[model samples]
Target chain A: MTQATRVHVAVPNAPYDVHVGEGVLQGIAAATAGADRVAVVSDREVCALHGDLRRHGVDAPMLEFDGGESIKTLGVLEEVLDFCAASSLSRSSILVAYGGGTVGDLTGMAASLFKRGLRVIQVPTTLLAQVDASVGGKTAINLAAGKNLAGTFHQPHAVFCDTGLLGTLSEAEYQSGLGEVIKTALIEGEPALAQLESISRDLGARAVTALSDTVARCVTTKARVVVSDPEERGARRSLNLGHTFAHAIEHAAGYGRVPHGIAVAVGLQLAASASERVYASSTDLGERIGRLLSAFGLPADLEELRSRYSLGAALTANALIEGLGHDKKGRVGAPEFVLMRGPGDIELGVMIAEEELRDLLA
Target chain B: MTQATRVHVAVPNAPYDVHVGEGVLQGIAAATAGADRVAVVSDREVCALHGDLRRHGVDAPMLEFDGGESIKTLGVLEEVLDFCAASSLSRSSILVAYGGGTVGDLTGMAASLFKRGLRVIQVPTTLLAQVDASVGGKTAINLAAGKNLAGTFHQPHAVFCDTGLLGTLSEAEYQSGLGEVIKTALIEGEPALAQLESISRDLGARAVTALSDTVARCVTTKARVVVSDPEERGARRSLNLGHTFAHAIEHAAGYGRVPHGIAVAVGLQLAASASERVYASSTDLGERIGRLLSAFGLPADLEELRSRYSLGAALTANALIEGLGHDKKGRVGAPEFVLMRGPGDIELGVMIAEEELRDLLA
Candidate 1:
């Protein structure tokens, strides 16, 4: 809490800051000085837990929504839009998202949509968001068909990730967030992979030092990739390592039932196995990912996840595979994936054969 | 039909060409040569009138929606998204919006939101969409509370304006588009204003040469302004010249009843009147605008429109005045007006006092 960790993501069109520390609300107040109107949007839980944003001195209206994964829908988006209109929120108005990734996603999309976009200050309050959502400008909601099927790339004006917000997160949420941290560690390579591999256990326990540093590291890693490819056309997809399989798992689980991090953790295993078969190497990459996930209380085995979710039948596996093809990241009839070559090297846009993928699924 | 007029809009972030001609469907085919997937989105009316896009040699799926004004809602947006998902429309898909501004607006927004945006080709059949909506990248849907309360600025990859399509447009719809063409001409200052004024009479009769040239000219004028300021940070506000007052008129008429172009036509006179009252000049700008509008079979007098829409007393005028204060372009208290000093000359962001504005309303 004494030291502040800051990361800057240069999206070219919209560069923003990601701050990790305690008592950072005052910093946000200073950044949004000349704004005509300031509005804070958050979920009901976060609003109740954090109280009103007015506590920071800059007075503004607090907009709250209820529900979890269900909130990421067009119906809910309209509700937020209606709230803005009722409050007379204009282009000059500033919107500060005061919750997790879902809140950030919904608010960011609203900011990008309302009058083509308003300046949004992302105040992500969850470990999952602090590392991932708060850094990249990807904002979206779930379509009835799938998660994040409907969305836009809208970068926030600034992202204030107060690590103090992590103290209140339940054990399950914190563990779920570790899935993304592990993904970042694995993708970044070398020093980070070695460092994370060493202290994966302590970080799972929410040790202040480990948690803050890991958060800053993940943000920094993602920022470097995002700055180079803001629109997800190239290197940015590396950030989605194991996400193709993960999206299918979430889709099959009916979204939120298996939290995003859990799905991603499971996705990394599938990706590792696919990598093992494709690369024709027995590098123990899958085994290392399994060990790291286990230390964090995450399910890493494909069989274990399938059993937990009752996903055994060929039909179910085929359906999940179908979801992968439907993912936004891939071109039609050309399903590509992000896979790990070894401990620290992640390869992007590796085309996977359908039958080969089927053999792995089986 | 032989010679196509091309206007290139330099958006810096994403530049595009606006091609105008009678038989330019072949040009559209050439533009979309290597696209992975081509899809046409339109209302049933356009689909029926235009027959099919296959005549241009590019066969693609046609997505349709029913209803008017009301179609520009979240319910419809979700439907279009569902269509994209069903069609497996991914990041590589090319969406051709082959209808009026509403279709272009809705489809452009869908393209922008679908996987954070796809390459959109705007084939504006209606004049309004051709000159304004398709050119500036301004996409929005009317909120129940207000018009364009929720929207985004997503530019199309290309725009094709087929003058031949105007053959099928109802007279009301065609004339309705003139409001925008007039607004652009007034703002462009010069030859555009003089040229439009000269051909005002024949153009009203659907003169092909006049319509095509005016369409090309208007597109060029808007492109110049958009290139300088793509996000409406400055000069782009001039495009909304007659739009502020027009929004109030449409809102009063319950939208679609008065028609956007008629309201804009009425809005122009109000803007001209306000300009006279504010500038304290002896310029004959208002009279020239009136003369031009009259030749096009448009009502040139404010009293004529007020009578037509049955707007009377201080209450209705005051209500619209209030709506101006709420405009996204100007600040909450001080509403700015875009006015013209003379032919080929415009004064943008002209702030008017509430009392003086009331005098015009009175």
Candidate 2:
């Protein structure tokens, strides 16, 4: 039994706590202690595997759905809301989202839209969700125009990252989460970057202590960023370091074709390479990140990613550029990229021309 | 030309100005100054009559729909988002919500969800929207379960309450706006209540100065309430004075059948009567409010309301009580009602038993 690490997120008007450890799912009881009613919204597989909340002393009705990027749609969102209505969930009720990022996103969105807003407790079962998606208030579902095109910034009431649940993840799924871990390390500066590099082997082996410590660190870093800029007006854009390109890739490749974090992994490399071209920073930075990603069984670049996944004819520079046009972060002119001058030294909203981007991709 | 009164709403993270006066729609250009592009979402009839943004120097594309309670649905919300995509609205672009409360609510919800959020400038054409709905950040669309069951608290960048547009409203529509005015006065306390009493005749005659001053005062009252509690967690619930019963009435009466503010007018009387029974407050208060409603050509009680509108079989006491069960503001036990002790002396979240409520309605 590993000691649980707690990270406090101080988003304005909606502060919450995140617990990370082997058996933190038990904390769901404490998180929802006073809730009039607790309803669980979860991935179908996760519910089947670990569905009994009564074992943890939470006697709540559960609503399960197939979890994937495909489920992140407005139609699915309405179904979740309908379930909430049927469950008689009031503003005083709490909704526990139990699954990976897709379940968390869909449930978080449902909680936000159901009766204006309902308090939500996130119990993330995947490493990617544990480290990143479940911490921030950014809850979204996809529209036909783009991914996460329609959503809200409704922060969770509490987050429980039970790393014990990760024991069931497939090898590819575990590596997918490490992609975000690497992205966070790059954004967190030299010491964190070095720490991730040192633990890359242990993380690859899925060591309990290594996973717990890394999840706590990623959550701490994310909490700090979210507190400063909860709405992503300025500094919060730093968290989108690899996300702009990642979203474009996901859009061009067709949603659900490639894992989100894997796309983010390739996005990090693209951002780093573009940083070298735009800022003329150390070329060594990209190489170092690539090596770390490779050590964790993740794709280090687009060419490697293409070999691993079928991106089809959509994975073109032109298609990606066109996809970039629909990015939520986009403004009046050219889409701004979160480029790195170096680790911890990130520039937000950096405009890179289409011609220059095309040349770089070529 | 009457001077436009400006009220600053200081909702944290999103603050904007509300301008109230005749012909204030001309100020639309200044509110959306540096926007990459400006797009209009408006009521179809309003657009045909006054949608020419070119005269105001805001040459933006327009999207119009039939505006009413029927349009406040997830389906219509999706159409609005699709139009935003079709119009190429980015985060930097401005969406001008130009119509009555329906248009404002739909457009504001779309603005909040489109690409996470887009800046919206509200150009409220209806008197009800001018005083209340347009100024508050609460944007919602109805669900099959209840009215405003799905929504967000996305504040507008600016509000332009063009009193000139009220000239085209039907007699019932004009009085509908007065219903909310009466509710605001009651919650605002003595001075506001007396002021409405003094100017009720001028307001009924649609005098320009009377309308401008009254709108500014209502905005000031609402702005103060919203700034203190942006998310309706505590003090803000008082703003829902007649709204609990009002929403129930609208729900039972079938949406689009009853004017929202008119339902609120009768709701105000019911709450006043409830307060008298529960708190032993003055019986004079209910009578005083009734007179004010009559002066404004509004329904003062349920009997008056039923006489004026076809409530069918839905306006029964049991049906309304059932409707209260689905209110977003409800909790675990009994649904809380926003009761009043006297003018400007409002009580929030007062739980009245089902039997007691039935007796009061009887």
Model 1 bad stretches (over 4 Å):
A309-315, B311-315
Question: Taking the tens digit of each residue's C-alpha lDDT, what string does model 2 give over A1-362?
Answer: 58799899988777999999999887778778888888988788876787656667888888888889889877788888888888888888999898999999999988998888999989888999999999998898888888888888889999999999898888888888988999899889999999998988999999999999999999999999999989888998998988888988898888988899989988999999899889865668889988988898888888787767855466888888887887878775468899998889999989987787897555
Name the TM-score of candidate 1: 0.97
> Model 1 clash pairs?
A116-B152, B189-B344, B190-B344
DockQ of each: 0.74, 0.67
**Model 2 chain B poorest 10 in a row by lDDT:** B305-314
CAPRI-style grade of the A/B interface in model 1 = medium
Candidate 1 lDDT over residue span A1-362, tens digit each: 45588888878866888888776666888877878877878777876787767767768777887636878989889988877776677788888888888999999898888877888999888898998987788899988777898888888888887777788888778877898998998888868878998888778877777878888899999899989888888889998888988888777666777778878888898999999888988877788888988898888776777776676652266877877776778887677899888766878889888888888766
Q: Which parts of model 2 are misplaced by more than 4 Å?
A: none
Model 1, B206-237: lDDT tens digits are: 78888888889898988999888988888778
